[model samples]
Target: MLVLAFASSVENAVQRQLGIAVSVEMLISAKTKVTSCMEYVLVWDMPIVQFGGGIYRRRHTRIFGDQGHASPTICAYSLTRNKE
Candidate 1:
């Protein structure tokens, strides 16, 4: 899974242009300074509760197990808000 986020904040045109210029410069710097991106792998070695990644639909009850034991029961009340 890959998550990408690009955020740029600038007030005026000059600032925005400068921000773009700086971002391009940084990308070049990163490409030169860092090793291969393909060589690096993102590994999450934590448990389900600790590892924050999931998609919970609305009006659903979800249960989780911990090491073959029942951990907790999580009921999804809404997609936006979670009710415990």
Candidate 2:
């Protein structure tokens, strides 16, 4: 599944940004860089980065399991706010 999140300081700037909860310690453990935009993160591993095509740096989008047999479409859940 795909998950979209930002650092502990940003908010939902767009419509349809589904919010979820994540602990600060958990986020730190997972190792994430700054993310000002979710658009940039989702396309990090596509054939575009070689051309210097993103605003924020992130780890490559992970495609888990045997990619050859994995589903073409990913199920995505999103968002977690530091406060209400």
Candidate 3:
């Protein structure tokens, strides 16, 4: 529910900025498959120190990585047109 609200807010912001509304269908069809993996790197250098693990399994480790932090989560709704 929270993710849906966030997506709706983001969609509204995008529409307002673009001066046009985007169809929800378009948003649903645009989702990409994601595979998350963990890695450790220097904060400043950003070079890989370790790799090949899931964040959940390595939660105790000081170093971790996240990729989909800003990715949008979307929900689909059926399209309907009202005829008067």
Please name the candidate that would achieve the greatest lDDT relative to the true structure: 2
* 1-84 per-residue lDDT for model 1 (tens digits): 322222121122112211211111223354566653322223221122212454222222133322212212221212224323
Off by over 4 Å in 1: 1-38, 50-84
Candidates' C-alpha lDDT: 0.24, 0.28, 0.25
Question: Which regions of candidate 3 fall more than 4 Å away from where they truly are?
Answer: 1-30, 43-84
Encode model 3's per-residue lDDT on 33-84: one tens digit a residue.
7655433221221112233542122231233322211212111111121121
Clashes of each: 0, 1, 0
Candidate 3 weakest lDDT stretch, 10 residues? 73-82
Error of 3 at 1 (Å): 42
Question: Which residues of candidate 2, in runs, are more than 4 Å off?
Answer: 1-48, 52-75, 79-84
lDDT, candidate 2, 1-84, per-residue tens: 343433222122221234444332223334667554232112112211222543332232353321112222332221222223
Residue pairs of candidate 3 with colliding backbone atoms:
none
Per-prediction CA RMSD (Å): 19.1, 17.0, 21.0
Task: Sort the predicted structures by lDDT, highest score first.
Answer: 2, 3, 1
